[model samples]
Target chain A: SQKIEQNSEALNIQEGKTATLTCNYTNYSPAYLQWYRQDPGRGPVFLLLIRENEKEKRKERLKVTFDTTLKQSLFHITASQPADSATYLCAPSRGSARQLTFGSGTQLTVLP
Target chain B: GAGVSQSPSNKVTEKGKDVELRCDPISGHTALYWYRQRLGQGLEFLIYFQGNSAPDKSGLPSDRFSAERTGESVSTLTIQRTQQEDSAVYLCASSVSGDPSNQPQHFGDGTRLSIL
Candidate 1:
């Protein structure tokens, strides 16, 4: 069976600091990986995507790195603010499969 | 352009009853998907449909779960004899095609189902 794991523990960080989240997977080689931000009672919003062949991808204050050798991906949010608090999910997709297998996700709380 | 949209944003039903969830994909999108998210858990793939081809229903948990897509547009997920464990937020997403390596899926505010 394939499994995706994110840091299940909640992360608390001071505002204006950098927050890093980790995602690891076993028994799968996804063609692409993606990150999504989900707020309470809302659907996940697509954030950034990185391909297995790509080392890194960035969008504004967000950055993601995919290391196929380690089967891990790291998501970083810089200058985090209180409004940036939400659960971050890492999803990896297999080629020709429309669905993505998501990790458990990490809850990030940026305290003021 | 409109994003994916789901109806009956919230549903509460008795156990053993049947429930149907609807999803309207973005116009012109060739692929649609359904997922389930339990409280405090990650999204679980449920089903996938591409164009007019047969859907990939491997992810459905049991025979009680089924879904249908018409003309590459609207879709419906039906659960028969719902169980308490079936309570979760049912999500629907769609992309220009079934290949996620090339296109990103657009999600809709899911229908939160509560089986009492």
Candidate 2:
């Protein structure tokens, strides 16, 4: 079966430090991968998306790197702040349609 | 300008009873989806609707779960004889089209359903 795994533990970092999250998947070749930010009791908010052919994508201080060979992706937030604390989710789509299979998110807490 | 909207931000119901959740997609969106999020779990795909094509119901957990969409507009998901395990946040999302390559989904504040 297709499976996606993310860090189950919460990631804590001091203010201005860099926060890195990882997502790994097995038994699937997704065409695109997306990242989302979800706060407690709220739905996920879209963050950034990286395609299979693309090795890396960046938005502001956030960056996403897709390594299809490794079936893994890394999300980074440079200069992280307390406000950046939230659960980050990664979803991958296999076909042209946006039917996504999401992995359990990794919670990041940036202390002030 | 409006995002996807789901009704009854929270619902509490008894087991063995039926419940209906509603979702209003963006005005021009042609694709709608239903998902369930259990506590401490990731989103689980329930169903998908696109234009007038037959819905992809493969994700539904059982016969107790069914959904209906009026064209590209409103969608309703009904759970019959709900079980305690049915408790979860039911989410609705919509994109410009069913072609996943063309658009990203916009989610609404979910309807949290609690079965007692």
Candidate 3:
């Protein structure tokens, strides 16, 4: 069985600073990883995706890194703002077209 | 029309009752997925639908839970004899296909199920 772990505690950071969240997996080798932002009471919204062969992926101020060797992925929000606060989830999937295994997610709070 | 849509934004049902939640995927998407998010827990994959058939149902928790899709568009997840443990937000997502790389899934607002 495959398992995914993420930072369980909420991350409080000052606005305009960078926030980094980590996602680690065990007993699985996925072909790609995805990041999503989920607001309270709302479903997750896709943010970025990075393949196993890709080292990094960036969209706007969001950046995601995939390290197959470490079995980990890091999601970074640069120039974080209050609006950027949300629960960040990392999903790693194995096959080309299959369901993804998601982590519990890290709640990010950007304080002004 | 633009994004995945789920009905009964909130569902309040009594234990031992049955509940049906609906999901309308994007117009052209061929893959649909159902998930449950319990309080303080991560999203748990319930089932996946490709076209009109479910190829992966490994995440369904029990026999009481079942889902069906038709016309490769609308999907309904039914819970029979629901229990308190079945209380969670039911989310639906769809994508062009479940491509492992670069394909991002769009999610619906979700149906908040509260079993009392």
Winning model by DockQ = 1
Off by more than 4 A, model 2:
none
lDDT of 2 by residue, B29-111 (tens): 98888999999899999998889989989899999999999988999999999999999999998888757543577898899
DockQ of 2: 0.63
User: How do the residues B47-89 of candidate 3 rate in per-residue lDDT, one tens digit apiece?
Assistant: 9888755458888999999998886789999999999999999
- Which docking category, incorrect, acceptable, medium or high, applies to candidate 2? medium
Each model's TM-score?
0.96, 0.97, 0.96
Model 3, residue A5: distance off in Å is 1.2
Per-residue lDDT of model 2, residues A21-86, tens digit only: 999999988888999999988888889989999999999999999999999999999999899999
lDDT values, one for every candidate: 0.91, 0.90, 0.90
In angstroms, how far off is B49's CA in candidate 1?
A: 0.5
Chain A fold similarity by TM-score, each prediction: 0.97, 0.96, 0.96
Lowest lDDT 10-residue stretch of candidate 1 chain A? A93-102
Q: Which ten residues in a row have the lowest lDDT in candidate 3 chain A?
A: A93-102
Candidate 3 TM-score restricted to chain A: 0.96
The worst-scoring run of ten residues by lDDT in candidate 2 chain B lies at B96-105
